[model samples]
Target: MGAVAKKELKQYFHSPVAYVCIGVLMALFGFFYTQVLISGSSSNISYVYSNMFVWCMLVIPILTMRTLSEERRNKTDQALLTAPVSTMGIAGGKFVGAFSIYGLAMTMSLIPAVVLSFVGKPNWGMIFGEYLGALFFGMAMTAIGIFVSSLTENPVIAAIGSLGIAIFLMVIDSVSSAVNNPVLSKVVSWISFSTRYQQFTSGTFDISSVVFFLSVTVAMLFLTSRRLESRRWN
Candidate 1:
């Protein structure tokens, strides 16, 4: 798994994907941080963190689109499958590789918060919660992107499919509220990623929300592994 993950990370850096994704995330983070500073808004950096969902929705697909789809398109996935590695290992490795790049970008976000601490006392606890929440959210999004990538050989299609799903999840909170059926609304709310993510921005450690993100991530990776297994047999 480590070898696979290293290979994926190497592939990302060798191409433009890693640079572009990380650059975009940093640029956006800086922009938001600047806005917050200029506006003299709340000293809490959670405000900047709250806007990260949009950034994840934009970059995660690009980071993961080629993970499996391009290998299959190039007829290289057969080699991987024939090697001494399980399908779940491959999926997990891919997820880790993509998530690492995102994690690095998120880590860099701390610089702004650190800088904020110099001028004004920032809420480290809330900042910590927001950071942790963002990583969990990114983990789930990366898994979803990998699963979408596993379903197609076309990288563009995989990216589009992942983006579509991300957008759907983003709006699901509003959809849940608008639903008339009580049971259906409850179910939709349960699955709404954005709603759960917001729970952490308040500086509280919510174990259930963390578990929900992990559960979704594991389920998506399992489905991706099953897809790979099917392809191996066929």
Candidate 2:
């Protein structure tokens, strides 16, 4: 697993994909930071973090789209399946590789928070919570992308499929608001990613939300492994 992860991480750095994703994230973060600073909203980092969901939705697909798809496309998946590693190991390694890039990009984008600390008393608790939330959210999204990628040999198809799912998840919260049925609304809200994420933005460290994100990530990766295992047999 470690070897696979290292190889995937190396591949990420060897290509422009990782750099481009990081650059896009950094550019979005810079724009949000400037807007927040200019608007005198340094005290609240939630806006900046919340806005990042949109950017994550865009970049995560690009990052994970090629994970399994490229292997299949290049006829390398056979080697991976016949190797000593388990399917879960392969999926987990790819997840970690993609997530490491996501985490590093996010960490770099937190420079604005450090700068704000010098100027005024920023809510460190809220900032920490938001960052944690973003990390979990990104992990879940990346897992979903990985699962989507496993379903197709074409990276473009994988990206589009993942993007559609991401958009659906993002739109769930909005859709829930319009529903008048109480039970249905509650169910929809409960399933919405933003609903759980909002807790962290509000500086609330809800253990359940953390578990929910991790659970989704694990479930997706499990499904991805299953998909690969089936392909291995077929």
Candidate 3:
């Protein structure tokens, strides 16, 4: 698993894609950071976090689009499958690699938060909760992208499919409101990413929200491993 993770990380660094993605993420973060801190004179960092969540909808798909898809495209997936490593290890390794980059990007984005701390007495607890939520959110989104990458050999298709799923999750609250059945609507809202994330942004460390994000990450990784295993048999 470590080997696979190292390879994935190395691949990312060796390619231009990683740099481009990081550049875009930093640019977006800078925009929000400046607008919220400098222009608005607000000590609240939640706005920056909320905007990052939306940006993740696009960044994550680009990051994970080629994880498994590129392997299949290059006819290297067979070698990976036949290796001694378990399917779950490969999936987990890929997820960790992609998530490592996501975490790095998030850390870079937090520089503005650190700067803000010097200017005003922001709630440190709330900031911590927001960062935790962002980490969990990135993990779940990366897992979803990995699963989508497993479904297609074409990276473009994987990216588009992952983006579609991310958008769906982001807008799930609106979709739930259109449902007439109260029970069904409640159920739908329960699974919405925003519903869970709102707790953290509001300075609440809800255990249920943490579990929900972890469950999504684990379930998606499990599904990805199963998909690879099925291909091994075929």
Task: Give the per-residue lDDT of model 2 (tens digit) for 1-234.
Answer: 787899999999999999999999999988887787777867756889899987887899999999999999999999999999999999999999999999999899779788877876778888888999999999999999999999989999999999999889889877877877889888877778888888989889999889999999999999999998998899
* Candidate ranking (TM-score, best to worst): 2, 1, 3
Candidate number achieving the greatest lDDT relative to the actual structure: 2
Single out the weakest 10-residue window by summed lDDT for candidate 2.
36-45
How big is the positional error of residue 87 in model 3, measured in Å on the Cα after superposition?
0.3
TM per candidate comes to: 0.96, 0.97, 0.96
Quote the positional error of residue 47 for candidate 2 in Å.
1.2
The per-prediction CA RMSD against the true structure, in angstroms, equals 1.1, 1.0, 1.3
What is the overall TM-score of model 1 with all chains considered together?
0.96
Residue 232 shift from truth in candidate 3, angstroms: 1.3
Q: Is candidate 2 or candidate 3 better by lDDT?
A: 2
